[model samples]
Target chain A: MTDNSAHGLEAREDEWLAVRCQLGERAAFDELVARWHEPLWRYVRRVTAEDEAAREVLQDVWVRVIRGIVRLREGSKLRPWLFGIARRALMDRLRERYATPAAVPLQDFDLAADQDTSALEEDLASMQQGLEELPVTEREVLTLFYLRELSLAEVAEVLGVPAGTVKSRLFRARQMLRRDMDTKGRPV
Target chain B: MNQTNPAHPGGSPTLPDVQRLLDAELSLRSRLGYVALLLGSLGMAALAGALWLTEPALPFRTQVAFALMIVIGLSWTVFSVWVLRHRRVLYARQHIVAGRMAVAFTSVFVVSALAIGYGSGKDGAYAAAALGGVMLIGAVLMLLRGHRAFNRLAERRDGLARELGRST
Candidate 1:
């Protein structure tokens, strides 16, 4: 089977599991937890940038998943919905962690206009460092869109932002990463 | 923290631990509670339907049907209201569809009730009652705005799904 068709089938299975779960089937729920736990953990870890916070956020997400599973109609949308819940939980935890009265705006650092093809194709270590240099919002948008391979809309849903906003965030994030690469002076 | 690869952060639980947590927290009691709630509501509805469908062979049978309808309808109202209040996430498409179905049903009922009331010349009271029902319908439709936002998000999801197919 083609990859997309396979994904479609897997999503249908998730939907079936979700319907069974809503009917109070423990085994179905167990399968859901088993299937999604690692990917969710990784997504939450990347988004929150702290293992402890990610763990807490994940617990909250699962609690909500249990409560909200009955309402999820489309199985294909399950992954996006789970990530969206995690993102909201992570935001709540961040708010509580900082106790900051005002929301932090996503930063837009200066973008260097010059092209750096060599830097663009950097070693894994430098790429990791480049990612670390980005703001939390930029990093999250990039990670969800690129590393996690979530569609732009899925990332936008997770972040509770417009698709247009996600596109701009992605563009700016890549630019900032390239700028960081240039500063590190990786050999051409 | 900065040195760590955030993608695979340190100290996160493995798959086994996650399964254990799910097992512990999703206990039998909670699952049973859900099953009981759903089954009870459905049973009441089925009983009401059966009572309504019985042949009107004797006097007071109509009264019995009316009484059963009122009781079952009230029970469903209370149950649904409680469920809605306790629901934490209202953005799911399923919930939206339910809400829309509710609004449509209420609208149809009110219109038919009004037609029967006035067509039979029951006076202005029937119109007044229908207006009250309209207010309830308004409230339900208002709560359904979340569905619109969800649809917008779903559109994006479709786009991404398409993109994934092309890339693959």
Candidate 2:
């Protein structure tokens, strides 16, 4: 409880700083930028498979913040709002990318990060294959949940789907992933 | 001149193009802070030389100022290099760097305050304090603003060379 409250105080301090930022207290925005850049970049990287796209989108998002941070309501909702900006930029990229190979190569995602690299590779391959084989809704939910680490509510926001729909898609996707993984590991 | 993208020839544009666009937009703002830093280094060096030349009757304040000018000038130089190196990550890391710069100056301030006084206050400490404070504050402000604005420029450098194995 104490730790949570401490965190809340720190967050409030950041909000105070953010208020200064909105009022053209340029220093405060530098602080805000420093504070949020990494996670935002990580999030952008995950959502946009293309590295260049993530970089481009993040730059655009910061430009938007510079131009429009004053209009943001709900001070504490800054994180979500920033996330929304990055996600929108990503969606724009997705729309623009005409020749994205449906078969996302295995080498694309860093497979070596998992300690059990071989098993994880097989699992990911099976999962990716299964996802490609599944309906787009199910595939997208599974990918976003597994790869992006977005909360259910946030996932729903990204997909423009209801929370219930996100849950349903997740449930169905999980069942599919399990079946696919089992088939790969099962004895013939 | 046109900015070229390394990856796709005649396909995508580089970050410099975007930066050029922004620079044009912000043309009127006299990077006063950057100019101050350039002048700060030169001014400090000249002041230190003048004070030393008129030595023997040097006051405590002048001695202190001389010491501070040397330290602040070097710190600013190092800081400029660091900023240029981390320009791409500038937006996300500006504050952290700013805090560090502030802390670094604070440490130097305390050290100069104590050290010069013990060695006979001929270092122009008062002038040093004022000069360092003003320039440090200015550099911090300007670099941070430039840093944030730099983040707006589109990043075009690609290839596996830039990826640092960050999965998250």
Candidate 3:
């Protein structure tokens, strides 16, 4: 099947699950938790870099999802909407930790245009250890993109940013990961 | 990569653990309880306000007491509504159930008030019956809206299931 058709099928399946949950099907909520828990856990675990924090944040994310799903008009957009709630939950936790209003500035990167692309061509799997050292903004974009967790458009929707901004953040994140690896005397 | 941490013996919350955490929020009892609270409070407030307005020779202290009862009832009504809307939200099926409850409660209220009004020959009871009638109409409208919304969602759900080769 073409990518578009595959995506369409996936969207329909997601919508089906969402509609079932909206209809107050107990089994559907179990299915939802079974299906998406690991992916969401990984995302939160990576971002928080703490097992305890990820557990707390993931629970909070599910709470928000359960309470807010009825308000979600377009069920086909469940993937992005779920991630968006996770993002907001993560930000709230981070804000509480740092006692700051703005957790991460989501500004467009002019510096991303100047980063070298040669080192980024290497497999990102080799640089997993370096991901923890990068800033949240860069690490987030890289995690969402490189982990194959979400498509570019889905990532943009989750971040509430333009597709171009997502691309720039990915570029900057890759370069930062490479530089971090190099400084630690690790092979790129 | 192994997502588990050996250091934290119980690394992450398992699926069961997560489900358990969400159980309170998804409790049907809690949702229904809030719905009952909302309807009961509204009914109390409406009756109290109607009596307060219709009784002409009520003492000043009696008027103050009625005003307090109305305020307290309305406060509970607002609290129940907020809890239902935000904390323990009513899903489509729950909405239908709540709507039916509202209709049933209001119908009983209207019937009781009308009987009391005709039997006692009191204007206050008549005023209360009028309020109950208004509530009954609102409840019927709410129930109709809920049914329409549920059917729309169910239709889309069945269509998607068919397209995806799954049972509805």
Candidate 4:
């Protein structure tokens, strides 16, 4: 319950910042960028699996948000809206780079830190490998649901699908990941 | 959740460069260009609205105004549809649905106007009716296409719901 309240408070703060951004406050935009830049980039990178493409998509997404901020009527929806933009930008980049809407190939990420304990590294490697084997659509749904911690409705919004769609995709994704992890004798 | 943190040990190789990203947005020229495009679109829309409202009864002037309005209004509509399609944002489904309904309504209006013009008089009758017919056909075609797209989205939504053991 306390965690929920804290999250609500954080959302409210983001809403205030969004209102300031709508009113053309540069500092408000900067604050928003500082808060969301990392998370947004991570989401894009996971979707596209290409660092350079993700960077380009991130740049384009911000350009769009800056241009269209005034059109955003509900500041409370700022987080989902930003994720939605990142999703669209990533899709556009992928569509342009590939003639067909091909499933994204998961690029290698260096999940091991030299200073980290061995057990954590093994968990990270297993998780990453499990994620890499899933289809792109399932992978995307899982990433948004588990990694981003977005609700079904929020994931639907980011993916431009109904909440029902998100729910099913998430279920299937979890099933697939669990099966894969179990086959490898690793905990999901 | 810590994975989202910029300083997280599992951070992706392409870590978010917030300063560099902010720097990209600080260009005065690009901002000015955006403002200019917005202002220009608004101006054109307003002008089109005014011309449509004050449409003169004189045949030639009315014809000229109608032509201009069609050019400006339809151009704007086409541009809007293009942008919405290309952007494919989260709320695009809502906008596209609304746009299709609007187009459908406009088609009915065009056909009615043609009927009324025919009943009123023969002066400028053929030309006006011809143009109206063309517009009505175009609008109906667009509406049909929009409906198909909307239906596909709806079906996908329903199918997903069914898969999740929910009836839609």
Candidate 5:
């Protein structure tokens, strides 16, 4: 298993890399992207649930990184700050598609209720379209918490809010998602 | 975090997709890598043979250096092959560590090689030298970028490990 404190160093290096990226180093930006892409993708996937949409959000994030990274040289603000940018990019699309998506697509809510995190890898093609149907807020909070594994504080950082708010919002989001899943007849 | 019946974390669709993509890419990458390794071994053997025929009285220093390169190159090939078979055993960040270290080591080696004028002017030497240089540069870049992704993964895995430890 990986050490926690050792992982802290990685965040520091990412901050350092972000500083380099702001200086027009495409290599640094790619490094930044490469470093964060999977988590970000997982986060976005939770929020959007659509593989193509998540990919689009990630691609847009990269484009923004190219254009706005120079303005983000404040070292400590990269991770959540970048996540915030991703959130906005995701939100913009959500707004365009704001037709009231299903609370939880039937298949997703039906995922064997007792399964755990390791279960996400059981099948890819089976769950792709189902994930896209989750409520956007549920998707976001879940992605930030479980998928990307950011702390409440970091999720707040990404959302540009206080950590306390992240907790409350996450609590509310989870409750709502649970209610939604139960309504769809899942064990929740 | 999703209300997915509080079950099945690893079964997410995204993991499989990423795994599939990574597996396919790793396969293609190592095929070319295997070819390169084969050619490298053959070339090194040929060099050793030529030395035996034309410079039979080569000094101990030259002989040791040649032996070292051949050994390192062959060992790397074996390790790379091992990596191919057990790709799932390696987490994202572990790849970052070893991969980045490799880049760092390669650059250091290449710079030292350049300083020593490794194959400086013989036929195919320039191409070989440039190939090494590019490989070194690319690895450095990958290592730098891979570190960020690895950080989040490590954090997530840390949480999972802790939870698992608690469960056990």
Candidate 6:
């Protein structure tokens, strides 16, 4: 099948899940968490750079999703909507952390340090380390575009920015990631 | 991505933990409980207010007490409304259930008010019956609205499922 057709199918499936959720099907929610949990966890973990903080943010994300899903008019936009909620939760956490003094940065904690020592794993670990060192905005666009694999339009929707703005951010994020990786002696 | 944490193995929140966190918010019992609380509070306030307005030659203390009851009932009503709107949101199915509850409760209230008004021939009971009738109308409207919303969503759900070649 063509990519467009596959994407269309995925969208329909997302809408199906969303409609079931809005209908208050308990099992639909379980299915929702099951399907999106790992991807969302990876997104949150990458953005926050902390396991505990990611867990908290993810929990908050689900709370918002549950309370707010009924208000979602277009269920096909669930992917971006979920990411948007995650972004909002991240922003709220950032605001809270800024408001409170003596907030310790958790970036030093390496997530892939203790993983398998294969060559590919090492490369990915170095890349992950490089990603953590980038600015939040750059890291975010890269994660949403590449890691989470949202289309440019979807990324624009999640960021609530114009498509042009998303393009510019993606371009700048790529440049920044390349430089950060080079400085860390990791291949881009 | 490797999501494991060496410091706290299995520290990442499992699905059950997330579900448990959402348990209170997703509790059908809690949502319906709020609905009942809202209806009961509104009923209490209406009754208190009706008595206060229609009863003549009442003592100052009784009037004060009636006013207090109205205020207390209204406070509870407001709290319940806030909780339902913001925290324990009612989804399409839940909305239908809540609307049915409202309809049944208001119907009973109206019938009871009518019986009291006819049996005791009290002006306050008649006023309460009028208020109950208004509430009943609102409840019926709410139920109809819920049905419309649910049917729309269900139809769309089925359509999407069919398009995706999946069972509804």
| DockQ values, each candidate | 0.11, 0.02, 0.53, 0.05, 0.01, 0.52
Which number leads on lDDT?
A: 3
Tens digit of per-residue lDDT, candidate 3, span B1-168: 124445334466676677776687799998999899999999999999999999999999999999998999999999999999899998999999999999999999999999998999999998999999999999999999999989999999899888988887
C-alpha RMSD by candidate, in order: 12.0, 18.0, 3.2, 14.0, 16.5, 6.3
Q: Which stretches of candidate 1 lie over 4 Å from their true place?
A: A1-7, A101-126, A185-188, B1-9, B30-168
TM-score of 4: 0.51
Which residue pairs clash within candidate 1? Answer: none
Q: Evaluate model 3 with DockQ and give the value.
A: 0.53
Rank by TM-score (best first): 3, 6, 1, 4, 5, 2
lDDT of 1: 0.61
Candidate 4 Cα outliers beyond 4 Å, as residue runs? A1-4, A102-126, A184-187, B1-18, B28-168
Write model 5 residue lDDT over A1-188, tens digit each, in one string: 36566456545555566645433333454556556766676676667765567666766665555446545545556777778888989877777787664453322233234344343334332444434455666456656765444656778778776766565555555555555546766444
What is the full ranking by DockQ, best candidate first? Answer: 3, 6, 1, 4, 2, 5
Instruction: State candidate 4's DockQ.
Output: 0.05
lDDT of 6 by residue, B43-102 (tens): 999999998899999999999999999999999999999999889999999999999999
Model 5 misplaced regions, further than 4 Å: A1-8, A99-134, A180-188, B1-168
Name the DockQ score for candidate 2: 0.02
List model 1 lDDT by residue over A44-77, tens digit each.
Answer: 7767766777777877888788777756766567
Worst ten in a row by lDDT for model 1 chain A: A117-126
Off by over 4 Å in 6: A100-126, B1-11
Candidate 1 or 2, higher TM-score?
Answer: 1
* lDDT tens digits, residue span A1-188, model 2: 59567555544554555455543444456666666665565555544534566667767767666545655555445655666776677666666775562542211222233232233324442344455565444555565555433556767776676777666656655565557657777311
> Would you list the rank order by lDDT, best first?
3, 6, 1, 4, 5, 2
DockQ category of candidate 5: incorrect
Measured by TM-score, the strongest candidate is 3
- TM-score, per-candidate, Cα-based: 0.53, 0.39, 0.92, 0.51, 0.42, 0.89
